[model samples]
Target chain A: MSAVRERNSSAWLLPPRPGVDHGLRKDMRRFEDQDEVDIAIVGCGAGGSTMLQRLARAGWTAVGFDAGPFWDPERDWVSDEAGSHHLYWTEPRVIDGTDPVPLGSNNSGRGVGGSMVHFAGYTPRFHPSDFHTFTADGVGADWPIGYSDLRSFYEDIEEELPVAGEAWPWGDPHKYTYRPHPVSGNGEIFLRGAFASGITAKVGPVAIANGRFGNRPHCIYRGFCLQGCKVNAKASPLITHIPDALAHGAEVRADSMVTRIGFDERTGKATGVHYVRAGVERFQRARIVAVAGYSIETPRLLLNSANARFPEGMCNDFDQVGRYLMVQGAPQTAGRFAAEVRMYKAPPPEVSTEQFYETDPSKPYKRGFSIQTVSPLPITWAEHVMAQGHWGAELRRYMSDYPHWACLGALCEFLPLAENRVSLSEEKDRHGLPVAKFSYSQCENDQQLLKAAQSVMERILTAAGAEETMTVKRYAHLVGGARMAADEHHGVVDSSCRSFAIPNLYITDGSVLPTQGSANPALTIMALAARTAAILVKGD
Target chain B: MSLPLSPRDGGERYPGFSSVDESDHWDRATQGAVLVRLGLPPDIRFFTAREEAVARALFDQLLDQHSDPRVPVVNMVDSRLAEAETDGWRYADLPEDGQAWRETLAALDQDATERHGQGFPEVTLDQQASLLRAVQDLGYAKWHGMTAARVWSLWTRYACTAFYSHPWAWDEIGFPGPAYPRGYKNLGLDRLEPFEVRDARPAQDPAANAGGDG
Candidate 1:
């Protein structure tokens, strides 16, 4: 066998080295020659990585399979372009072709660290109303659990991740004493601007310990966290829980693409997972299976796993596996200044204002919006600005001084719409697996809310001394395709992240988000993963 | 957020550089020498030629056509020489010896002035002759230094590093300068006069005329 093939096959033999966990080494060894494992986790990203660590600590023998390679701080950033595309495990040719092509939505990673490696590190708890969004607003279905139920779990996640910034007094409060310090100048400017215009704004927490409590180093303000942190400061799945899990004896296999969830002839539960390794198809049996391959890939796997007993595909009895998609508003606005302001040299903005988070009884829409601050570099700003025809030397002259620009955008809450769905496309990959195609449209209420939020953004920027401004029309905050609820009829999973029909199967990614909150979803997803782990540990 | 000192604050001061003696003749020569070391084509003839009137006339004509004449001309000459040298032009390659380089520069300066003078009208010959005399008395080295300094100042303002390789300087200027040209009015103009607002001309209403005819 070639060196690369040998490396791929022997990946599991290398025991978890110190500080390098996430079960990658262990998984590689467990599946090196064996045909099956006791339990299999389909993804090695944020949710999957977290689950693997928990399972390993609990002495559950599990293996993880991902389509991409392990995270290497030096090689990953230098080789990969800094954008949303870096999140996925795509072919080289596809990456080359899609480098310049902008997409409408961002997806999760397919590598060792998975999407969590590229996450912006913004973490926030879902409010009480977020859990009962459907009951409160009569929009989507209610989650199986409430905010009160998940509060302690949220604290656990915060401690594990060691988030920065203080908790909001008005929002779901936490007992954790560690609060992130006040956000820097740019963040304060955004909050001030929002408050000046009657919008409630406050400092929000991010999973950036910055060397306060963890072995991870402090943020160097390199402004390239999305590309992968070179200093290992940010709490990505690879850096945090994944290593601990691997040290505790969990195995993680990189570049092993799981094709289907194989089931036994007599039993309805999954018996094993069929995966492709170095062009060889192999079946690995496990007592329990966790499909943490994200909303997109998880459903695609199930839809492809067709058989004689379950003709419609695994867990397709209700045909509600890929329904009720919710995506947040993509509305954004930017402003330019006269002096130098190096906004891109620091971590992403640490403050967020959710004054309009709840539904207004008088308004046409049932849910309000949340506005957050972000600072981008000149090149990114130029591309977005020039897309609106602000081009040529005039634009160049305006961008000559750094740090003279700032932006505020709204993540408008999206109601779960059943018509928005994910389906297998006619397009196939090199392995003959069908690609996931998404069909989505915003409701009239969603559009109105987005429009109102955009106007508010414009007014805030104008008040903050912005001479010029512009907005991005479409958003990419994809959420809620495989929602969680109390019953199988209305949702795919329950509050504990377990599928309503399958006893052992669970999903801890954005797939279980019933209602899209008006904020970044990373924090909520982390909180849910922690909550799921707690529930499983308590044997509930 | 206090704005940096205005451009008139003797331009942004650079450390380890003398700004006290603006009229010091030697300061100009040193500036011109630095530009030459940075691969720029120095005006060697400006430091050697005896006829002040002819030199002054040529300098004035160059300044009139190109707002900042020194660096632009040097850049053009260096680029042409580089191309010619690459193409194996005999005269394009400078000698290893410093003196030989100086001689070649002097010859190129003479050729440049002849080409520039060829474009002017014959009626302005007498006026040009008098200005050339004044330039000769000013001393060639002194004049060349002053011109080089002015060019460097303009280039630095736009964040260009034709004479410097400091990355910090590039970052300060926000790198790529203005995307649009300052336009015809700013080019070579000594002063920027206020523009007069003109009333809009009546719209050419072809429809109105056509209706009346119908």
Candidate 2:
């Protein structure tokens, strides 16, 4: 963290005390010592932290654990390309196959805030039709629960978090109370292109607060969203739900990496989580257990928790724990502008067009993508632009038009292919845990989606008066490992995101997304977490 | 906290994990590790002296930088090779990066010897560029025994990471570099902070500052 400037004559010099047991040590001597709680959430990321808030508000004792330490943003946050690498999940997992997935720290995260610390806060809700993709498009599995099932849950989360944006009338289930953030320069150019290209565009209902909301400051637009948000403004769970849960007597054990879900072998019910902290194995007893380790680690944990009763890994009766992984495309197309768009001047883009989200038979793709205006910072520019060069002048030529470069990319929808998945590899990680081996391949449906996005983007950028369109990259968002389904045998988790085989186990993260709509999955993950919490409150 | 295994000679099969015992110091800062040129260790860990010399020569031509005030691109490559930190996977036909670098350098030297009657490092910059283009253009030479395009990308990725991660390169591009406690307030479109510099080139022309016939 850098020197702080004052706002309202008093700036937050440091974050509030996280919890009473924020950094409690695990006493290995007391091997049988089990701190019993109402709920035990493995991973204090977006979903777990959101669930923690609800559980605490309902007056339930909850404890959360994270593999990484609690980042003291004031002191620990770094703002460079090298420094940003620390914000993402650092465990070794092989992402291979046809498309060499950049499935490392960039897509996942650890620590208290989890990946949301590095997420762009582009939290768009999935459309109502997104829940029934199988029925509408005859492709992809349908979500067991519909938009109406999680409508109020979405509202509950939106009200608590400082989310901004107007609700889309097309398929948005709930009314977003707060308005969207001001349009960025990138958004203005994108809007011009969208309007010209005969498509729809609107400001987001993103998790970023419009301005100063409560104690959190407004967006200064430092463009470090991919890195850790040092200002505590970017609505990461580190600043939002984690703090609230801690205040409500929820205990958080940072540096506690859960290795297995402890179970009663006889009844096959989850006892709690078995985690290693400070080189000691400890087990906490809980009435309920949830693994919210995003997409990768969630399934990895399930596969690792194999035992006698459920020898094929706990709750993995169908061996569907790590199958059917979906890496949705967040592709970018670079374009040169006449003047200065200053696309990188602000925070993440406020406006995004979703007119192409539905299943349009006229289009080449089964589903579509949402394209928004954006610009790359210098580091990304160096990799994607300057990297392909003849010599110094080639790199320099790309750098010379820094002020005049603009881009619009898509969070394209991806359907589950049985072959594109994650499984335990022969190699082991630093912890001696079996490393996740990926078999990902971008299918023809993805190419069709990209072609649609490319045509729309070209028209939009051409409309926005772009001088040239450069390279295109398909950045993937990890989704669909422990997918939720109405039919028990068809998917990993049931409608409530609870394991159909194991009663006490729940998988509530992006892993539960049966279908990844053309929207950033953070908002949906949080809403589902809230919905799961609401269901648990009903004693289901 | 204790990471379970003590990696020897920078063998991370997967790079960038600290003692995984705890997570504060998770990354070993492998990419931009402390830039030290003090004692020089007297020798290289991964690249052979011949490989290093030729790779450095090729990069100098590729980056159009044959001078000081340049970021240590060859050192960075050596560091990555030593750590076994790769781009994870590459083209199936091409060997791993460590082997690829060695093979490519050997080809460039051999090609230079055949044409200019000199080693790759001893050739003129023009001759060096042509030899490099043989691998890139997939010309009359098999070059690296791999596709010319793959060889080009291997060198390009290493050179780009080393060049752009430095403060010198950040200054050249007018990038404000690193956002932290001192975040931007003048954040509107076309707005610049007092510290930020405007580009001194034709803004619209994508190829404005090629400094060549390009």
Candidate 3:
């Protein structure tokens, strides 16, 4: 019997239903000249796609626009590095300071589904402690709303996307939407270390569908989770939210790069958005407008919208449009076990040990990090193997050990630092808008966090009977260029993720996150977008 | 033998499968149609003749895999640059990767020429290895504004990326490329698929890669 013939629908992408059902193909596309709606959402990635779904459901005549092309997986994609060339936001940005972040697809994705198209399904929620960073420790600002505030939104989102996970003894306010994925050999190797070190490890609550749910498919575990899943198994926004949004009488237009916020008076309120598509200039009018272009471009839009009324920028009256940036300083640890781990055969994040997720008073650092299992693709493995400053036979020996390697990445909670932020560069894009400039350096607390996280990860790896362990410190994702705070003076947006100066404008991407929690930021961004959507639906 | 100037294009493509699958399309029309171009460019897109020579020499030491025709690591890298697919970020001191390759390769050839009369590719394998060691040592002189250490790192990155992305390289590492519609079911620590190669060699001896000498 052939595996191809008997293979269930879960092994492949859900074909765009029968007739005029697929979002882009449906009778919803707007003529470029006639572009006006009640709500206009920018950058149809995670936040925009999630907000579009909720807004469409709430009966807001919403239209979403993305700068990149709408990806039709069957027509456009094959799981390869070639796909990354177009998918990643490869626009040139000046990265300054000692530890400037790795950009491109790593920070932001460029297409219809946005960064979610490339992100793994490692969807853990933020701890309650993550919300009250300032209250617990006097270093960073605390989130205006806490865990209890967004708990329902998280639960609703979990149900909608239906994440696969197991409940933990450590308090999480949500329930599993689906049964956890089966444990893999890499997971077993990681769990052995965690158990030996007396740390609690559980199946990570990933956004991957475990079984056939909605129109999406279950994870086939082909092991290209970071790359766009050819199968609709991974719960990317393209498969999960965008399709739902389009079905509900909403329109999503791609290749439309929103360059400026159209405002009679920006601080007074937003009237519409100015966008360019196919080299044709178009203006989209809306009573309500939202900017969900992730962290870099979200702030870049506000900064670029500096008009006669708002001299500096639309939301930058207090110079808070692009401040208090937070990127979780990640330090990865890899270990080689005698037994073959076959890390490549399973999903990237198989298990998560959040035992160190909270602050320990005994430790010098105020916050902590969690270690989650990870194994990179072949190209990345080869690069890292050679990075050990050896070549020839030694490098060859390491390549043979790729099947035997097990690894974990620590997501340390990062404090929002004023100096670490995005700004508009003098250099402009092809559209004449200033490129997003990134400036960041790891602070003393960040150093403290890295040192502590590295020590614990090394300890965990050592206890697992690893022949050897390697630790590498690097940057993960970017968050909080336009953070949400209660006061207008403190942040760009209010607790509702609405621009305080411009009441009609809302920002609900990673940009609105005040403090970065030690989790993959996508799920939190979606939950925040849902909460904000609820508020927008219920009025002021 | 040189590659075909233009591959024979197959007209129809079976919807879901890629060019890599022989059953899907007899001739690759589009999956990697761009990859099959009108002959190799007169000069590799990003590299100068000198740089190409250096890359050829360096990959010999970097990959050094025992294969029938050592996987064309340099050709793969040339294709990537021609497509302008590079790691988005680079050290501020380094020029844009396209220019950086030319400068660094020229520097490597110069260094080799100074030691011996010929360029990198013409040198003996042991001499090429010695030159690589010099490049790794930070104190070794650099040209065209890049440090020797940075140049060595750059070459190593491209060499490894190009080498490991190919099926020939996968064969050496015992990798079964691309589990797609058919996913792996036997995920036990030591279990493998029927086609997958199980590592028969014993584990690395403790003293072999002890991390001290480098």
* TM-score leader: 3
**Alpha carbon deviation, residue B23, candidate 2 (Å):** 29
Model 1, A120-212: lDDT tens digits are: 677777778887776787886677778888777676666666677765754666544455544544565676677677766666577776443
- Give the number of the best model, judged by DockQ: 3
Residue-wise lDDT of candidate 2 within B129-209, one digit each (tens)? 767655666732344566665677678777776666654555455555554445567644566665665544444364433
Question: How high is each candidate's interface RMSD, in Å?
Answer: 20.4, 8.1, 7.6
Best by lDDT: 3
Model 2 DockQ reads 0.21
**Residue by residue across A213-305, what tens digits does model 3's lDDT show?**
645556677687776776677777777777556656678888999989889752477888899989988888888899999988898899899
Candidate 1 wrong stretches, greater than 4 Å = A1-36, A79-86, A89-105, A175-177, A181-185, A391-402, B1-214
Candidate 2, which segments miss by more than 4 Å at Cα? A1-33, A173-175, A386-391, B1-51, B76-155, B187-189, B207-214
What tier of docking accuracy does candidate 3 attain?
acceptable
- Model 1 lDDT tens row, B1-214: 1112222211122222221222132223223322233254434332233322333333333222212322333333233233321111111122211233244334324534565653223216444433333333343233333332222222121122221122222232232211111111211101111221111111211112222100
lDDT of 3 by residue, B1-214 (tens): 1111111111111112232332132112223532332234334666667677778777777765433346667777887777667666554556657777777777778878889988988888888878877777663355445666557767877887776665444544555555555666777577776666565543652224444222
lDDT of each: 0.55, 0.70, 0.73
DockQ ranking, best first? 3, 2, 1
lDDT, residue A76, candidate 2: 65
TM-score of each: 0.67, 0.84, 0.89
**A463: Cα error in model 1, Å:** 2.6
